[model samples]
Target: MEATFVIVGGGIAGVSCAETLAFFEPDKSIILLSESSLIKTVINLHAITRTLTQFNIQEMESSEFSLKHPNITVIHDTLVEINDGEHYILTSTNKTIKYEYLCLCTGAQPKLIPQAELFEEIIGIRDTDSVEIFLQKINRAKKVAIVGNGGIASELAYKIKNTQVHWIIKDKHISATFVEPGAAEFFLSSLNKDVQEEQVTKRMRYQEEYSHRSGAALGPDWYKNLIIKGAGDLNIPSEIKIHYETEISNIQRSNNSPYALEVTLSNGDKFTCDMIISATGVTARKSFVSKNELELSNTGEIKVNEFMQTNLQNVYAAGDVCCANWKLAKHWFQMKLWTQARQMGSYAAKAMVGHLNNEEVLQDFCFEMFAHSTKLFGYKVILLGLFNGQKLGTNYEILIRMTKGLEYIKFVLEDNKLQGAVLIGDTDLEEMAENLILNQIDLSPYGDDILNPDIDIEDYFD
Candidate 1:
């Protein structure tokens, strides 16, 4: 088959790119080669701010997606090889497709612990399939050990109940991936108990499922649709024992013991469990193409320039499968997030279309600052810019204001200019926070009043 544009992978990034291409260039043929029968699409998206987007992921049938666009065709197949030099690709089913422009949204694979492959009881949560298998295992498990401090680990640690949970981490506090020690400490109380989830106008995200695809996308609120109860008939939703400042040093399967697995920690602590979840993080999928052909980052992701184009001509990549090689905006950075995947996909489409028309395309405004809205421990969380003071290290200063269970607010400042912020709860400071970071407005005169409850920050900023 031949097309003007071809996108690989069925995840949000690829699907978004395909939809955008089909929308703008209706006269041209667009092919979306997907490995799975399902495609993930973003719906009910609310642009809380320019960069901060809240949306739900809908896993649509690939056939349904194809039906929506007359020029776009969805092909259920996996890309086995890429011939960038000749501008063609080989699929697993032995079909050769040629394209004028190609975008690789192959996504990522879980970076499981080294011993993950040695045992069947240990698993890493990635797509819907892994989560389903994990649910089945936990439904019968008496005890489970969770490792990692990222979003997936934090969610699993917070949501799963009715079983003994040993949350092993190498951080000083919980939820360190999303917040600082202070914010994490605020979240500690909620971790050990069932806190009431607040209803918010913002939309919550859900995972993307393909009938049986390996590289589907994961989003939040997955537990709502599925049962998270553990072994035992009494549905007591408590008991998450957090092992802070440590990691899983070793894991072994038991042959005759009552427990299915025994795990050892880095601090010489050992625990026996029925299941183990490795949520360390994800690495790029690079098996289809060689590094020599397409440049790769140190983290094993495809390196793409400002145009989202790989080193090869007319070949581009987005989402978890690619890395931004260009110098990033001061406040904006890359994270393998649902919002970022959508932004990158949409941006990639614009860049490709501009390339075809020989038009100059400027960088997207969404790249001006890092913004995201998510739920952690059932609380609404909004992150802007370098929320954790990221690369600024200890050189920066932070102003914090909180009321325990009610809310927690933090501001990262450098030379009295707002650099980043973390607003946990219904603070309604997203617009002000994003504008302050993007405009680089000096806050020296305002001082700590920037986070003061009495001060009308929205009015001053507006």
Candidate 2:
């Protein structure tokens, strides 16, 4: 008659799920298992989003969460294996525990992108340790090269001022992940703060006004000799070099030079460098669970119903593990973000308790369209709902409002509802904007407020 719930992982999803479960069923026992002792510190790429006041406030510091939850037991051990049957789970530490329910919030791993081996070899920046090593290498580096096409690459291109940057992007254009073409242009323009727009008019195709700030511009020949290759390989020298979308085929020590290490690329390409860091994205980490433990999506994420219940009965999953159909991006599911995982954890816990009560629950406890926003280096990037453009139909009304280098706001209005937006630089109306997106509020009042920044229109949504 023990109603004990076993939660795996100590990240935001796992912690939040434990909190929710503790709240719903105070009489039931709750235990949280984590690989790291840093129970509160979840590996978040968008840590700035947590700092921003526009979103939900994080209650406990990463280190203090377990101390706050007296009812939640925490075990700091690596989850090397999981054998989740109907009533129990075997831990990596050789401990067996009985549970009425199991929650899988064990996040993801860094994806070893095939062609990104060179990038990983020279300037990888994949994690905290890698970023530290990269910074150390940069301090001593005369020139730096970047690979990949995302916010991290964009920020790296803008941040490292003294070092010469050779950015190799597979795509001809800028980040196609969050921003649209027009907004992408604006963001690209912001990178070239050292150069004026008219001075680089020939490359104007890459220069779109980012905000009213006046100086951001995507520099000239900054990414020259930009090789467009598919699934390339990366080879590294003893010094520093990064190859994009490439894999390391072979590695060996130099015969003549004692300090030199030689590497071969998958595509027969070779390069030598001081250090390598991989900014390659994260992988959905389910390696511990036996392949037959649960059904997995193509992306390696756990397949779950609307209630966050995994294919394995009583095994609930939230966060990066659960499939997410983002409302703003209009894409089905993607990994490598903390926002969806946090919401999914809360929803999963709620649904689990609801089932215990034999009560009806919402189809999905969380919203379909998840929003994420963060500041990479200095540039502000916001992703609302979904972006894949599949759910809202082919045709939708789009209004783009901008002020060069200072502000950029693109509103996706469909059926008179503010579907989604990506805001940058100026965030005066950020909270109101998010409220509108979440509630799908009528857009008439905020229309004038957007143009006239001086208006104190508190009743816009009211």
Candidate 3:
């Protein structure tokens, strides 16, 4: 079997690449091989700012890809080996397919806690199945411990009610992956806030059935609708105890306590919980590709250039599976987020098509700045550029404005130019903030007036 283009992995990156390819090159044959029977598709894509986007991810039947694109064929198969020299790949089912262009979107896997023996008692929430498993465990759990300082850990700390949460973070504050100490303090108040009654609003949906294999990592808003509750009744207010600047020293099954497990923290504190959710983070998944066949980064990620092309001819990679080895735009940095996955996938498709046509292709404008939007503790969170003054050393100024329980806005200014911003709540400053950062407008003359309540920053910018 052969095709003009063969994409491995059915995550957002692969599906988006295939969709874009079909739209641009209708005559070319494309084959999308996936280990999972279900594929993820992004819907309701909304451009909140030039670089920031909001979208809902839907898990659809793999057959939908072929039905949507007459030139594209979807196959449920696992990629086993890639023969770069022969320009062919071997599948797990003993099938060989040759392609002129190959894109690998095999995303990353969770970096679980380093206890090999207690793997069954720990859960790393990445995909739908993992979330289901977490829900099942929490239903019968009285107390659960979560380890990590990233998005998943932060969200779980706030969303998991009725169960006492032992949020263990190696950082001094919460949500360190997205916000600073001030913002973390702002979010601290919401952790124990009365749980809001469930609302029947539109939300991203998930469907799962026994298939040939598991599906891709879930996209944004993966837990928006799910009923995340614990064994305690509704009247009991949520309880969360944060262990800052510490990590898990050891974990073992409890002998005398009623709890299922005993966890010892690096600070010499010990606690017993029913289970532990390790959101420690993810590492790139590159085990399928032989080291001799592809150039890899020091961190085991496939190394790709600006065009998303690998060292091997006709081979490319995108999303979490690959690292951006090229010089990045000043304001843009890479994060293993769904937004970046979509952008990388789309850009890779254009790059591939341009290579085929011998046409010059420029980098996408979205890469000019880094932006992300997510909800934590029921508040809208927007991050732009170097929001926390990353890489700026100690030579930056921060401006902040806060209205308790309403909004918290922060701006990172370097040499009077907007370098980054964190807009929490519905501050309605994302567009203006993005423009200020992109245009490098100097706001020195405005002084503290920029964040003054009386002054409309947007109007001044306009």
Query: Would you estimate the TM-scores of all the predictions?
Result: 0.96, 0.71, 0.96
lDDT measured at residue 109 in model 3 versus the true structure, 0 to 100:
88
Q: Could you give candidate 1's per-residue lDDT for residues 218-312 as a string of tens digits?
A: 76666655657688546666688899898888888766778999888889988788988999988887668532378888888999999999999
Report the poorest 10 consecutive residues by lDDT, candidate 1: 203-212
Q: Using TM-score, rank the candidates from best to worst.
A: 1, 3, 2
lDDT of 2 by residue, 1-462 (tens): 123788887666887688888878877788787765544432222323222213222323334765666667777655555455546777667777778888888776555446444344454443334444555566555444455566567656655544344455554455655666787677765564542222211110111111111111122122222221111122321121234445556655546642234556655765443333344455566756543467877777887777888877688888766674333233234445555566678888888888888889774423544556555324556666543343678676677678877777776777666766677664555555566666777766566444454655435554
- Candidate 2 clashes: the total is 64
- After superposition, candidate 3 runs with Cα above 4 Å error: 197-213
What lDDT, from 0 to 1, does candidate 3 have?
0.85
* Model 2 per-residue lDDT at 72: 75
